[model samples]
Target chain A: MAHDAAAGAQPDPSSGGWSREVDLPSERGASRLVMEELLEQLGHHGWEPTDIFGIHLAVEEAIVNAIVHGNKLDPAKTVRVSCAVTPQMARIEITDAGVGFDPAAVPDCTRDERLEVPSGRGVMLMRSFMTTIAYNARGNSVLLEKQRAPHAG
Target chain B: MTAHRRIDTSKVGEVTVVRFIDKKILDEASIQELGAELFGLVEQLNRKSILLNFADVEFLSSAALGKLITLDRKVKTAKGRLKMSNIRPEILEVFQITKLNKVFDIRGDEAEAIAAFQ
Candidate 1:
């Protein structure tokens, strides 16, 4: 479950970046390993603390949504994650094996009536932290991209 | 005087001041445990006022936010008040982004939050 740069995770020397693709089981607490590895890669690439925080939050939300909401924590289901990180940007794609969902159906948690709802803020947080968040037609796969700040890069 | 593995709690006058033990509150199991402990304060002990201090917390995800929201509801149902303080700028942004800032009574520090309970 431990993913380090040396053990299968690829570091692109030519591009001065790191990229990794892995399949994580649909289980609670499965995203910790990937988040640690991704954060390490971001730090190695000189991402600022603020930027790292946002990236970490956004990525965590995406993976959790994939595992819990999309996959429904089915042991048979797996979440496929692809991450690419550089000083300039970080891009992550996560896909889960499930029925998927409609992003439009999610209520606006920020609205006055829904403000007190205990759930449904994951998508909003992902979109706010990452520069761009896109979901495929199936809505089971999400791509999160964070463009590094000018000063941080 | 409940034992908590994921958080630390203390008494501040009538308010139960709580602090997180983990820097990153991302995982599901821990967040669940945290929710249990927080809910215990209102549902079990019947504490009327609570203040959660987040000085040691560096990262928070939507799951953790869900727990906090649920805890807020529990406190309200018990006719109590829940407040949070000492959140770092980055984590504070998470609240602002979700607009939970409007849902919870967030203060600048432990002292301010405890005083607000008065």
Candidate 2:
């Protein structure tokens, strides 16, 4: 579509979808620009509002984790992000240029004692909002996917 | 009283009612500023009964949630109470998913939340 091209999203001939790639600085709020474009593409593809909200939240949490936790907000580091969106689904991959950490090591924030803790809930929220989230062996990169829910009669 | 850029505050009886200025509370800077302003209400002004009205907030991240948790802790430590109301369904789902619904007293509306305060 005209809008997709204007946003630098090229046709994904394989799936009749569109895709985009971006490299973001390891800085707070940098993800906003990327999310703005991606969200527009999701809307253009006719995604439901609820699904879009979940996808937006999941991707945002992932990007924040990459910048804050993985890259530690080092100016020297950059987060590489790629995304593909179709009428049926959306997929994203984010990679950070810093030492990665173990996802499993993150504590369960929902536990009784940990309920009041201020941090460590980002990873859990990402997992809950995204349909599937997979991390690389080094945990420096993550892939998030969400499928469009069928329309109600 | 510290001037607030991220929140608007008013008093309903003895309760300090706070509403967010931002519709989407996600960015780091805003979250940080929000945390400071909210903590100031209890730590500096010593306003005991606090109600965070989420009527304007459509979206918030875990970082925002962190600020709320810390504010709750501060209120409890000061022997004050904290409650939230007017959260949209999607945002409410976030609390339910994280089980934070159990951590904070969430009311159906601002009037209900303020009335529950003692």
Compared with the true structure, the alpha-carbon lDDT of candidate 1 equals 0.88
Write model 2 residue lDDT over B1-118, tens digit each, in one string. 5789999999999999999999999999999999999999999999999999999998999999999999999999999999999999999999998899999999999999988985
What candidate 2 gets wrong by more than 4 Å, as runs, is A1-7
List-wise, what DockQ does each model earn? 0.86, 0.90
Q: Which candidate tops TM-score?
A: 2
- Name the top DockQ candidate: 2
Colliding pairs, model 1:
none
List the global CA lDDT of all models: 0.88, 0.90
Native-referenced TM-scores of chain A, all candidate models: 0.92, 0.91
Q: Which residue pairs clash in candidate 2?
A: none
Error of 2 at B24 (Å): 1.0
Q: After superposition, how far is residue A5 of candidate 1 from its true place, in Å?
A: 12
